[model samples]
Target: MYSEEQKMYFSKNLLDWYQTHKRDLPWRRSKNPYYIWISEVMLQQTRVDTVIPYFHRFIDQFPTVEALATAPEENVLKAWEGLGYYSRARNLQSAVREVHERYDGVVPASKEDISALKGVGPYTSGAILSIAYNKPEPAVDGNVMRVLSRYFLIEEDIMKPSTRTIMEKLARELILDGTASDFNQALMELGAMVCTPRSPHCLTCPVMAHCSAREAGMEEALPIKKKAKPPRPELRAVALIEGTGEHAGKWLIRQRPQEGLLARMWELPHVEWATTAWQSDEDNQEALRAALAEQEQIGIQPEDWFMDTEHIFSHIVWKMKVYRAKLGDANRPSTGEEWIPFHYRWVGPEDLQNYAFPNVFVRIMREWQEGNEA
Candidate 1:
């Protein structure tokens, strides 16, 4: 813990450093609560460089809370297509709609009120209240945690609730008497630029002299962390089925179920690897044919289909073998399964921009496009 005078001095020195060295980010240029709220939510677990374009495009499309509230969920989801964590986008829309109806399209000014919104937690509420409304509240995120831990030489595991309690207490105690917003931003900026998670640049830190961790030669080890969980493995097989005749130019794309991972997103039909027995290519094809016949009651021959390719996720490795099959002369698929018409939408050489696909899908599309180009 710091003496009141030491806290004030540290806050002043950090703010001075920030005034001279802070990056001129787009979000920093405005005090509007809506814009600040949007930027804060988007920056969660996402880098500034990645969020910039998304921020601009999103703001342009929905300039105000009212605009966001009025926009269709599909259009909002489309705009947020490439960005992962689809739940954030959904929560954002829900919050905006609530604000429009309940708050008269005005974001709440108090921390309690702001925190009441869907997905808006203590940190987000503090950020909006202090940064946008100049309220005297501290926004204690990981960055703030690092700075506080180093300055106080705290040794608690940052993942633990007790550590968060201690950090928040210290943060509230250290906030400058009337400069809480600037003080919080300075701490965040200092952590991001100088008191980094890795080798901290203590020599350049404005409050290095006041940092107990630096003084004790434990700057790198002050903020203890919890061990991470092991990643789970999964496998999937995707089918790139094609249509014939007028629909010949299209391919089948189905919307994912509204629950579970990647909910409501469009994807090619797929089967879990565990659900099917692993077999040779010929055997696999026969198995797939039989499954389709039993499941969709499709009477299609397997010889007309050709293998496409595969993809993988963070925890899952997919050994997908895609099969391209041309439909018969019949307008209706012989299979009882719904044959949603998708044009071969040939994402030709440079024509892939017409499709808005997820990053994983985009990677696969690129590979297929490159093959076509070659």
Candidate 2:
């Protein structure tokens, strides 16, 4: 536990600094709980600079809770195209639908109601309640934890749930009367701007004089974090299936299954390999042809290697090798013994924007487009 004088100094100095130095972000312009909710979700594991445009576009497209709740899932996914971790977008829509139906389109101020919504965790719930409703709840996130750890010299591993609970309790106690909104934001601001993960700007930090980590020369090492396991690698073979005749200047794509990873998102036809041992171009193409025939009942004749790329997720990294290919027998159903799957589609350059694609597929398509134009 920290002394009252130390807590008071930190609270007063941080609030004073924040009033004059806070960034003029778009979300800060209003206390609308919906805007606060959207910004908090967008800010998770994403930088402010990267989220600004997406936030603006998202708000313009779905200006109100009712508007977002009523929008189609496809349109919502399209709007959230580039922002990965699409589960956030999906959960947001599901929760907003609840708010529309149950709460009369108003974001719930009570912790129990908001926290029960999909993807509305403690940090997000606290943010919505305090920033939008001016409640005295603490919005403790990684930023706040880092700031607290260094200032108070708490040496617990931040990755642990217990440490987070302690940080939350301390954060709540720091909120002075009528200052919860600014105080929480100020803590987050200090962490982002001064008490950074690497070399902290101690001299510029308002609470530096009382920072226990700075006093002990451990500012960079106070908030310990356990390293996460590396993403497992998976080798995959992708087919850039080109179209001919009536379907000229187009490529084949398909939507993923209704469940699992990247659910319902469009992607180029591809198959995963069990091992990392990469094969020769000809062998890889043969494997792709055979795999496509076996998996989707589609026949293909690979022309040549197109490119190699990879897409990383939190748990897996897909190392993809793409090959240019054409339909083995477009006019007949005998080649692979069946019709094209219902989820497949042939899309030209202009049609690419009509479907929502994972960023890796988008990258591949862009590269193909650029090479063709050249």
C-alpha local distance difference test of each model: 0.73, 0.91
Encode model 1's per-residue lDDT on 126-215: one tens digit a residue: 988888887888789999998888888888899998888888888877776677777778888898889998998989889888788888
Residue range 1-374, candidate 2, lDDT tens digits? 58999999999999999999999999999999999899999899899998999999999999999999999888889888888888899999999999999999999989999999999999999999999988999998989999999999999999999999999999998999999999989999999998898998988999888999999999988789999999999999999988887778888999999988888989999999966788899999999999999889888999999999999888899999999999887425656443577999989989977898989998888898899889
Q: Assess every candidate by TM-score.
A: 0.85, 0.97
Compute the lDDT for candidate 2. 0.91
Q: What lDDT does model 1 reach?
A: 0.73
Clash count for candidate 1 is: 8
Clashes of each: 8, 0
Question: Which residue pairs collide, candidate 1?
Answer: 249-343, 249-344, 250-342, 250-343, 250-344, 251-342, 251-343, 298-335
Q: What are the C-alpha RMSDs, in order, of all predicted structures?
A: 3.9, 1.7
Best by lDDT: 2
